[model samples]
Target chain A: MGARRQPGAGKVLRGLAMRRPLKEAGVLLVIALTATAASWALRPDRLPLRADPAFYRLELDAPLIDPGPALALYDEGQDLFVDTRPAPPGSLPTIPGAVPIRAASFDDDLLDLFDFLAPDDPVILFGDGNLVPVSNIAARLKERGYGNVRILRGGIKAWIKAQGPVTGTASGKEGS
Target chain B: MMRWLGLFCRLAVGGVFVFASWDKLLHPAAFAAAVDHYHLVPYPLLHPMAYALPLLELITGTALILGLCRRGAALIAGCLTVVFMIAIGSALIRGLDITCGCFHTDGGHAVGISLLVRDLVLLVMCWPPLWLADAGPRVPFLCKKD
Candidate 1:
């Protein structure tokens, strides 16, 4: 009976040992939650509890305009073409009259576009073969109440292939 | 010697997390955008997580640094590091060209193999503080007496 009791005692000790870490973890979680709630409450720029689902939809299902239609819009001189590539101000070749607005600096950069562009303007965003940056900017523009934003299909490469009017000197590998 | 090493690991991991949480806390909207780029969190829950995650990091980090609930903090740090590693690894596998948003929400290092390795190293650093008994004297209301 004493020998059998020894194993039970060891089990109890092991359980106690495990309980300490579990208790600590619970305490840590409570502290974190309380801190987070306090911080969120005090911060002036607290994020909205719920995100706009439309933003996600815009990001995932990017509205793309093919080069032919984009070029036609360009010829009509109505839609605003934005170069969304991550490049310096004047380095990258772009569609004539296209505004260079990198998504990384979208908040600061979009200010310049606001001088000439309106919320209702049809804006076409293009990147250097990657659609991710352009898509992000499109979602951002939507958030800012831009109603008609579209991404250029196949990016700048497609625009070049369509013989679209370019402003800067096109390096052979400009969009490749 | 092992105790000193544990202290070092504890401080190192804690300091990094505390530092990393700063910019995200400042520009949480940008951080939300960064997380959205990963496309992991559901859209409805995204903003809340973006708000909460940095706060969690700061709390756990400070706790670890202060040697208060070091084991728990270290465990949370390890868990975060693992999540980070997985996110980076998935990004690399998917060939997504995006900034890490680890330190800065705006323009941090791009997701790559190097970032994954860094997270792995941080994950390793979390081990000692988690397993080793704390060395210093415990404080009232701050640290638990082990």
Candidate 2:
């Protein structure tokens, strides 16, 4: 029987070197995917594989109305103003007659607010100073089929600066 | 000295990854919301990305700390850091006011120049492990014969 020829040392070393990183990457990916699957199966609070389409519908830069125009809307008494802060209604200053809707309690508040609001109602959402809450609540409102939602530019602080009528305490508290 | 530096870099980068993954792994929904603020990820991919990213961080971080595939773990960590820097840079350029979501999902630091600088520091830390051989002992059963 003829003896089989072995591969050269240089070639074997080259192959090993090339394959090592790819193999490491493969292992890394496998471990990650396996752990992700395990988390999904075991964790009660795991996220759904597919996100809600409502999130996609969220406007990255939702329309903004300045404090002056917002105040005018308030005077007209035809628009709905929502306080998107995470505090209790009377704890912080808010535009008078604005419906307090904390993002945490969005669903419950939306149910109550929806009863009085039509999908096409000119709704304005505001937060303390951070636009994150305002934009998020605006997106949620949009998801609920509220068509005319706009965030108040500069939030409640701007409203307070504009001398807009407010309910509860009117002190300009930051990050409420 | 170089070996010790490599070991330190590995642990530091890996520890950050492991630490950052904790809150994200536990609070997938909150992480999803945080990711949403970036507005870069597509809607359908958001949840899956949120789920997978943390697990990747956790496993890669563990591998790095254990000295099992240290180079590979460092590479992945480096790449993830680069991606994060890009995302943060994009957000800043776009003037999007969003939280960094680095450690805590809720009430985390806002995206700013400081966050970018921190990521740059992390990117620097990732290099030593990639270029230098690990000085630590191999993990039993998990590490292959080098």
Candidate 3:
């Protein structure tokens, strides 16, 4: 009896840690299992060919100081400024010489950009307030073999705030 | 022993499928959007497939999980998994970057290489268990007196 075996410290620790009140323990178990199942069910089997979000976003090769640099690029004809942001009541005050490409409904505008712009032509992407459409367009264009793709870091507001002025192309139709 | 395994298989696989189907059926538009995100199927057929798929997933999932008509249900589920794998594999090969949208939408996750890996793993898990059971063979065991 004096020499009777004792449980290991690890076992004791596990027992102490695992020992929850029955009711609470039951709920915890169910939740744990559910999470496990959900993760297992949703995990993908393969990788996407184009997995880089940054790559999908088209940006300028030049320094991004706001939309100002982007505006400058628009002026220099360095890159095409595809503004998916629709007009704000007044005409589109997009950087002069920049094309009007609304961020939304890409399938429509991309064709026009393709018709007018050259492949090696640089593209600066911006959304209304988000890069979703622009990123989406960048990804699609890359898929279509477009070589020069870049997203303006902060979109139009960044440009306007960063000493960037909208020049050229006074015709601001609601390019919805 | 076989009977117990069948029951286990039915509940495990079927319940998942049933719930998966129910969620999608509740919001077909969202599910369709999910399918569109996959880019495996084109626009024209996306709606029609979305309309029909959830129902199919539900019925087969229920049948397999409930242990009723399991043989047929398991076969269908297996086939569906195969079709999905092919579709997803083709999309990956074609350089489509979209979520598989297997369970829920609002999918922001990038389509990963894991997609193919996970599907291949699931196929391995599902195929063997499904092959052993004969049509309704377990039904007799259930009703049999001990």
Highest-DockQ candidate: 1
* Clash totals, every prediction: 0, 0, 29
* Candidate 2: tens digits of C-alpha lDDT, residues A1-176: 69898999999976766476567867898889887888788875455688976644655446767677789889999988888888887887778788988878888988887667889988888887577678888777778788798888668887888789877565655445
**Of the candidates shown, which would achieve the greatest TM-score relative to the real structure?**
1
lDDT of 3 at A168: 39
Candidate 1 DockQ, CA atoms: 0.41
lDDT of 1 by residue, A1-176 (tens): 45553567878976776676667767888887887788778975566689976654554434666677789999899998888888876676778788887777888888987788888988988887576667787888889988698888668777878788776654634634
Cα error, residue A14 of model 2, in Å, equals 9.4
Q: DockQ of candidates 1 onward, in order? A: 0.41, 0.40, 0.02
What value does the lDDT take at residue B1 in candidate 1?
A: 79
| TM of each candidate vs. truth | 0.61, 0.59, 0.42
Overall local distance difference test of candidate 1: 0.80
Greater-lDDT candidate between 1 and 2: 2
**Per TM-score, what order, best first?**
1, 2, 3
Model 3: how far is B88 from its true place, Å?
A: 2.0
Off by over 4 Å in 3: A1-176, B133-146
The positional error of residue B111 in candidate 1, measured at the CA in angstroms, is: 0.8
Give the candidate number with the greatest lDDT. Answer: 2
